[model samples]
Target: MGALGAGIAALGAGIGVGMIGSKATESIARQPEASGDIRTAMIITAALIEGAALFAIVVGLLSNG
Candidate 1:
């Protein structure tokens, strides 16, 4: 069960990061001049999502043991 939860958390994070990247790419395409800003925001948001996901996965695994 814990492993299942961890897998779900990782999956959710992957989807979230993918969506963020997709939108960032679209935004940059629409405004090449703001590409730097869009890329920065995307990286920051992805990092945050990853951090939360990591925390959740750790907790889930620990709960199993």
Candidate 2:
């Protein structure tokens, strides 16, 4: 159950990241001139989300271990 739960958490994270990428791409396409700022914000947001996902994965591993 521990590994199963962790896998599910990761699946959700993947979906969330995909969604963020899609939105960011659309935003950048709409305003090419703002690409720099949009890219920066998108990267920051992605990093933050990925960090939280990593933390959850670590906790899940420790708990399951």
lDDT of 2 by residue, 33-59 (tens): 999998899889888888888887777
TM-score of each candidate?
0.97, 0.88
lDDT of 1 by residue, 38-63 (tens): 99999999999999999999999999
Give me candidate 1's TM-score against the actual structure.
0.97
Cα shift from native, residue 5, model 2 (Å): 2.2
Q: What is residue 18's positional error in candidate 1, in angstroms?
A: 0.3
- lDDT of all predictions: 0.97, 0.85
User: Whose TM-score is greatest here?
Assistant: 1
Residue pairs that clash (backbone atoms under 3 angstroms), model 1: none
The top-ranked prediction according to lDDT is: 1
> What is the TM-score of candidate 2?
0.88
Give, for candidate 2, the lowest lDDT window spanning 10 residues.
Answer: 1-10
